[model samples]
Target chain A: MAFEQLAKDVPAYRAPGQQLGARMRMFERDKDELRKLGVPIETVELASETKHYRLASRNFYLPRLGFDAREGTARPPSKSAEGNRPPEVTFSVEEYEMILRAAARAQDLGHPSIARDAVAAVQKLSFDLPIIDPESTEWIVPTPAAGDSVILAVLDDALQRHKTVRLTYRSNEHGVVSRRDVSPYGLLMLRGRWFLVALDNRASAVRHFRVSRISRAVVSVRNAQRADFDVPSDFDIRDLSEERRAWELGDGRPISSVVEFDFSDAVAARGAELGERLTSGRASSRRFAVRRPESFVRWLLAFAGAARPISPHAIVSAWRAAAKDAYANYASADRGES
Target chain B: MTKRSADSASDQLNRVLIALAWLSDGQPHRLRDLATRVQVDERRLRSDLLAIASRTDDESLGALVGSRLSLDDRTVQLHLSLFRRPMALSPRESSAIELGLALIQHEWPRAEAAVAQSVRRRVSRLTTSPVTSSSNAPIHAIAEGMTEVARQSLQALRGALKTSRKARLQYQSFSATSASARTVHPFGLVLVRGMWYLVAHCERVRALRIFRLDRMVSVRVLASPSAKRGDEELRATLERGRAIVKGATERLRVRYSRKVAPWIREDFDVLEQEDGSVVVEHPLRDDAWALRHVMAYGPDALVIEPTRIRDEVACRFKAIARPRPRAAKRRSS
Candidate 1:
């Protein structure tokens, strides 16, 4: 019973005196036995009064027990003999290699990671099959670097602890630098770039931070408990980053705006799909609730006279002011040219 | 030799036909033996070869023969060119292939290093004339390497449906230390999103398993055959495997602020509604992993269901958030 308890209760490593009486003696004996088999063990003090024992390195073990005869014979009867015979065909190794090589090449060409994964997968299949030369299969393109090991480690710790982190981050826009304490939530990849969604301590709101821009990370003592928040099922990382629109502003409130477009502006609708909508109209004019108006305004301007923003007077005012500034600059440039 | 050429064209054809028959039948016929059997000298046989080559003016056949043959001596030797066949591609397939090749040639450094010569050869084969007809250039858009491989594997897997042979595979697993050999009865390959996966029965595990082919190290046709798998059984295995691997259904209850309440309601089903907050219930299998995931949201997400998960989260939070020992502080001082 003592041995059973030790087997069930004890971790892979235990410090001397950590276990009391019989359990301690058993641990010592086990350690000596493991040492005889060339296992390295280390003891470290975790706290002032407590010492913890652990394996100094990874250990590989094989079970001494063998399978029973009955278990060996327990396989179900052959069903192939009773089933209909399948057709016989063979693929040449060169042909299989060609397919794998094509896949690897496609990935090297800036295809998405999934495409590269597919190539790796097919290469593996070719390795198992008689049709492909294994030496010929290689990952043609290098995998994108997500970040340093330290960044991943910090992210893991932050994720596990539910604690906010303070970091000095540099922004890509004008090389601006700022210090922020944020509640780390989700780390995701968009178009080969890694981004972290965290609740900013200063603003007390959710913000997305690029992982590459983080210069240093310091764990905070404050426990930031997660509210009842779930990442929307329809939320796609690619859709959010691919196009900058008004809805991506991460603003606190959702704004309702109306806009009109001609048939030529149908391509602009694709950009609108990325934003949030409160009440949508399917005709030439559409109404949408957006978080970021800047993106929507920019998108509207791209169509020139083909599209116009009608509702949400604030957004219209901003657009009009921006248009006036642009016209003034163009007039100045034209006069300078004359 | 001159007299043999002067003979009827039909006679020359007959001798050529007989030689072709002998080659196909796998019958051993020495050049000396064949010359005597055909009632002609070695020189006379050479002239018949010249006649056969001259009579066959078909360019396709000529090109086929040109690729296969190498002339060394006056003595003629027939090269079996028919056995080597190139894969036929539709226009769409060819475009896809060209796009993949161009991407590798331009983007992948390792690919450029490894198959530089092959890429050059393929490029030479493509028509150099500018594409004036179509607005979208075929070479401009290329799928990723893995996506291309997945597409090709899916095609092969589809084709494998006709052939009932069991595939012998060497598969490398991310979690495992090394690759292991297994015999899998090929059922079908499924594409979920952009990744390609094979659903087959693992002989080693004696169970059905889903294998990501990219992780496959080597594949070969096994001599030890397998029977056809039932569609119902395959479907059941896939469902069960998916449930075991991905289906994590656990009941979670949490109290969220009214501000965060609507967001939760939009994402998950609410188990109960209260005055200031709402209790949200969700199912997950990996409770520890799920708890860690939920905790990442900070104070925005609170665990109220499954007392163990809640306790675990609180305990972990306290352990990490707790300050360093006084002794350690004193040592630093």
Candidate 2:
């Protein structure tokens, strides 16, 4: 047997020709290096003057996981890519599905760095699992719009190093371009748009800037080894990002108006809870304090016929006029009117 | 020459340790297979295996593998004590896991928050760098804004896809006055721009279709299994980019004004003219989407070809732009 033969050859294997002492010393040094690298190699003395070595725990090889069944099986499973995965090493059928979905989501993020990381992570996690072809799943996401990737890459690097960035930004309201030196706190995606939450040095206030509006960005290279600034401890990105509406991003005065939601779209109106729900007859409606009427009207147009602004003649008028303007662009072309 | 022998001492040590880690699984493996798996030379792998086997009795070596190893011409089996399974994740691998979980949480906040948090916590413990809150995370991906109906519909479609079942949806297209009910085999879901779309085989139309989640009034997963279809069909279409309506291969040329041409150029390949306007040929078969695409840009975009779509767009805009008597009356009152 191979074991019998190995036993007979054990002495020759250990001695290794004439450099027995040197080879043993080198092996010892190698062991120390592996230990320092967190290999978890543990040694114990056996009764017969022999040593026993083994890994301390499974945690060294895999992350400790406990799948919460309630969390995993909570819904029929439409909304999320990953559900309750097991806490231990074993993965349930549903958990496996969630992992695949999560993987798909990560690969589809459209950011090169994030996607690359996702692929690497999946490779590590699937050591013993079935070989998965990422192509089996699909994630259709928008890639960066031309110059936006450069902006994202720059911002990502600046955030990682805690550096101040200089940005040439375009104003949505004024159509004016201005330059600002800002210390980046963090970045968040809201309403399908990327916004950089940063402290504008000139403004002396932490404000969120739409990533798309920034035409040029350069990170401070002065302090390569040290961070240029510290992000304030109290800055929570969600506070500035949560429930932020397009109409509220402007500096315009707030306009109070009543918006009507058709019965078919009433559920959406109630879910948004824009403001107070008006007890209007069969159709439902909400009273809102809109900051930018044009933005608000444009958003309302997405609902097609399901919702419309009913009150505060100004908002209603703006809504009608904007729709008319959009209509004219299409209608006039047919009549040969520019 | 072995990759390890040519590598620096530290690299060689790392590779040998990694190889031992793989061999510690207590399973017999072919010598050639082990070398291939570890990306080392076969001769070097055999030497390392013999070195590990002979040192089983050495206390300083930490008993890396079994006290005795079974080795033959083709296969080697070792009883690994500490090196069993795989080694802890590298810093890069750990970062990948953390980032992936964060993305999953972003996509389905309500369903994946607890799982992502727990997994992240455990993974952070395994990682050299501890996990940080997503607020402090370098990249924060927030879920797109979706209505309750849309959210529910998305969930239903996902459930159907996982179970390989048919789903019924109340969907409204661009030109539809009201949502119409349809049954479809939920194949997969894709997110383009900010919208979630279900790529399915519509039973009613007997063709592949993509339905926007937000446009769906409601959705329900049917008990019946979906009709079988090759995934390649759907993959081939989406592999290129997000197409609104598949099989709309006819091209339509649209011109963007110079002011917005720069932005339009970012999203598509366009022919830049001397006058500064850019023209884009859209592979479109549907009038509804082409009109909406042009309408989205307001006056910045104009359709230059396919007069049929142009006329339809003009008619639709005329109807919408036509002042409603009720709206005019309410304002006057």
Candidate 3:
């Protein structure tokens, strides 16, 4: 019953079930709500008992979008035209093109629902113009693989419905497959993959599950109208996904681990607290509180001979064991073990 | 009510308003077609229309002030002058479009920023939702966090691409000790794994090079037009994954131990071994990438074949495991 018809003069209401006073009160309530939504609506009384409703200001509607030809150009204004002109609402073609391009780029970021919404918004904005296909091959974005898409679709539905999702997940450390029921909270796309931040029902802990590693997903359908759980206010998806390093993703206690980088690779470890600066002419060392020794060892191994783990005996021993195991694999293959 | 249900209720309201505005244009519209445009089923649309018509006075609400819905079997006619235009932009739509514009604005030129600002201001006025910055503040923070140098360089490169011209850049490569000047023809920009890279035909290398935008020290668009275009080639290269070097790619086979096999299978097509390990054949342009990849997983990932890569990784492992005299000095010191 909102914004139905507005004219200069409207006769008093006569037909209906509700009394005139009750209907007028409801109409007043609706008018207040519309005004709160930024609609500049005004009512004028033409007769003692009759009233007319109409949109009061032109600003209540979206202005016509046009390209400003004089964009980025400056000219000396005459005295007559200096202060008498009203501000014009217009956009440049460059701005429109940039918005269109960015919208296309965002659609490629791998979140299915956001991608759909982005395209829909683009369509609405460019309703008058020819539609630029967001799904075209011209835009090169790293799209999720087919397997990822299916998992994402399931997770998206679960999160939107606030349902518990049972996932058959493969752990990264041990390649172990296990089924767990979790309340899906939020999703984040980073490093070309989607990660679901959810609360594990069994563990009673919030955890990050990589969508790709989930082999199966079943969204709870019991009591479909009700939510299975509510996400805690303290659980922020950004804080959980902020861990950029592989070792930082672990939930265990942090262990102080020191790594020595050679003179050539010291630049790679520049951001960390430098124990021995590059100017020392020897190896530069830095310290890190590693939560997962296994992941840290693997990350250190990537540096090869240029970096060595110089830490609590456990870290060095783990690194050595990993290096020896890696060496043995190739050595065994060399001896026709394959 | 729960937040999800509340969101759905609000979403329904937006849909109804949009549908009403769409139908307000004095023409007969098919009920099914209107439902499709509003992203709702026909049954839901019919119910919504009935609900609106049921709670109306003689002069307002459903149909029109004077004439009510003239419902035929196929089409419904709405006689109303009000809401003849599309409804104001909803809150969520405004936020999404604002974020989209902010993305390019971070790397846009000064003149372009002015235009973007004007667009944002106009968009801000069009939204019926109360202006709340809290919902989208973090995303805008991330967009604005780009360094001034990178933003300027990106802006210059974008200008070059737009004009189909060459650009000169002082870029620092990962392997290089210092920045070097190079002229290149910009083909396109690719965002891979949250990092932006420019795929360009580097004049110095006489081939296409993927340059990280952040690695650029300075960039200037050249006036000369770059007649060559490589959109298809760039697409093919990116389709193969983030290729740093433009050349023939070699297929390198590596085996992931049982411990990481399940995780490895998530991203790659691999052959499962009887021992529960998985052998994944990955493409690479150089041995350096192979070395880093195999070494990154340590014992979990092992180079299976291509004796040269396997030997190189083995040699690196041996060197890392060997006790260094300098390492002993660190503990003593």
Question: Highest lDDT: which candidate?
Answer: 3
Against the true structure, candidate 2 reaches a TM-score of 0.65
Clashes of each: 45, 14, 0
lDDT of 1 by residue, A1-338 (tens): 23434344454334455555666666766754443222334454665555555542112111111112343323321121112232122223333345445554444322232232333233222212322233311112232333433664575457434566887886432235789888766554332334666778788777767665687887765534332233334443323333232245453676777776554433344334433454546466767666666645545554433455778998776555544444443344335641
Q: Per-residue CA lDDT of candidate 1, range B59-139, in tens?
A: 434443444333334333456533211111212233334444543343333433345445434422321222122111221
Candidate 1, residue A298: lDDT: 44
Off by over 4 Å in 3: A1-95, A127-138, A157-163, A201-205, A219-243, A250-253, A266-283, B1-83, B88-149, B214-217, B241-250, B262-276, B324-333
Minimal lDDT window, size 10, model 2 chain A: A74-83
Model 3 misses residue B35 by how many Å?
14
For each candidate, what is the lDDT? 0.46, 0.61, 0.64
Q: Candidate 1 regions off by >4 Å?
A: A1-153, A170-176, A213-215, A221-246, A249-251, A272-282, A331-338, B1-333
The candidate that wins on TM-score is 3
- The full ranking of all candidates by TM-score, starting with the best, is 3, 2, 1
- Write candidate 2's Cα lDDT for A1-338 as tens digits: 22223334345335636464665455555544555344555565667565555545553665533334554543222111123343444445455445655655554545544444444444444434433334333465654544576787799778866889999987543446899899988676665567787889987876667888899999998957567987777765544544467676533467788877765543344324665666764347678778767657656655443466778988777666756776676666657875
Better of 1 and 3 by TM-score: 3
Better of 1 and 3 by DockQ: 3
Q: Summarize candidate 3's per-residue lDDT along A120-141 as a digit string, tens digits.
A: 4553444222233332223345
